[model samples]
Target: MGRRPRQGPPRPPAAPADIQLASDPQPDLEHEQTVEAAAYYDVDLTNRLAERVEFFQCRFKKATLAGSHLAKVRFTDCLVETSDLSNLRAEKGTLERVKLSDCRMTGLAWSDGLISDATFTDCKIDLTNWRFARFDVVTFEDCNLSGADFTDADLRGASFTGCDLSGAQFHNAKMAGTRFRTCELEGVGGIANWEGAIVHPDDLLGLSYVLAGALGIVVRETDR
Candidate 1:
């Protein structure tokens, strides 16, 4: 008998109430502070270094985290929508039950991080690095992940639906129970090690061609 199907991504944490809003010239900017149930709008956090900062039930809208280093940071029940995360680096960071929608994540590096029960919807993740990262029940829905790197990442029980994963790398990754739904896998690497992964039958058409080329196999017609 085959293994049981993995469960879907866990639900996001509930939004907190009575959260304090950040005022102009935010004092918490670049400061190692714990802000809970807060909403930050249009904040400019460029090149900020946040170490051990924790944000719970927070919403960061149109905020910029470019070139920022977020080490050991925790974001729970947070909604980071329409935010710029370009060149953002997170080391040993954790994003649990968080949703990042419509966020620009190009060149973002989350290596050696823990991302559980997270949803990255409609985000641009091209050239993003997730090497050595561990993901559990994470979903990348309607996201552009072209040229993204997931080498040595543990992506068990993760799902990518309606995403453009062209030229993505999954070398040495743990892909147990991973699902690919309607994703563009053209030019993707490490397709040979997709054991226990689930894909639609139609997806095999594209994947087969890639694997065939890698193995130098030629297809010829023998019947008229």
Candidate 2:
């Protein structure tokens, strides 16, 4: 008998039980007065701003940072897991070698930031904004990024695998050597905005729909 086709890679284990939010509450920035290297777990940090802060090897587990702003900050080797950062902003910041796993960051904005060698695994980044940011050698694996925006960003050597990017916008973005593997791109904007984008041939199938609209041609499939 022929060997069966192997299933896809095993999904990562779910986050810890304590990582779940008990209630949807706003995060309190006043409580985060200190910048020490301690564990920040199960805290609500919504609508807060942390400027000129530095977090060295800190762990932010199961915390909520909704509508928070973090500017001129640096997170070195941090582990951010199961955090909810919806509508959060991180501008003019640096995140080097950080791991953001199993986080819910819908509508999060990360403009004018530097994220080098960072990994985002199994995260929900729907409608997130990455305008004018710089990402060098970043990897996004098994993430949901529907309607996310990458306008005017520098995405050199970035890879997206098994991600959903429906209706995502990439207007005026510099996407040199970017790869998308097994990802969905339905209704994504900025089709003619590929100044220096390099996509896989299989992914170009999705672009055909956009190109057809640009060239004012109708595509009709025939029954085989």
Pick by lDDT: which candidate is best? Answer: 1
Q: Which pairs of residues collide in candidate 2?
A: 27-44, 27-45, 27-46, 28-44
lDDT of 1: 0.85
The candidate 1 region of ten consecutive residues with least summed lDDT is 1-10
Mind giving the per-residue lDDT tens digits that candidate 2 earns over 1-68? Answer: 12221222322323332333324354344322434454678878777877766766667888877887
lDDT of 1 by residue, 1-224 (tens): 23343477568878786777777644444546788887788888888886888888998999888898888788998999999999998878899899999999999989889888899999999999999888877999999999999998887758999999999999988887788989899988887768878887868888887788779887567788
Q: How far is each candidate from the true structure, as Cα RMSD in Å?
A: 3.2, 8.8
lDDT (0 to 1) per candidate: 0.85, 0.74
The TM-score, computed over Cα atoms with residue i paired to residue i, of candidate 1 is: 0.90
> Among these predicted structures, which one has the highest TM-score?
1
TM-score for all models, in order of appearance? 0.90, 0.79
Number of clashes recorded per candidate: 0, 4
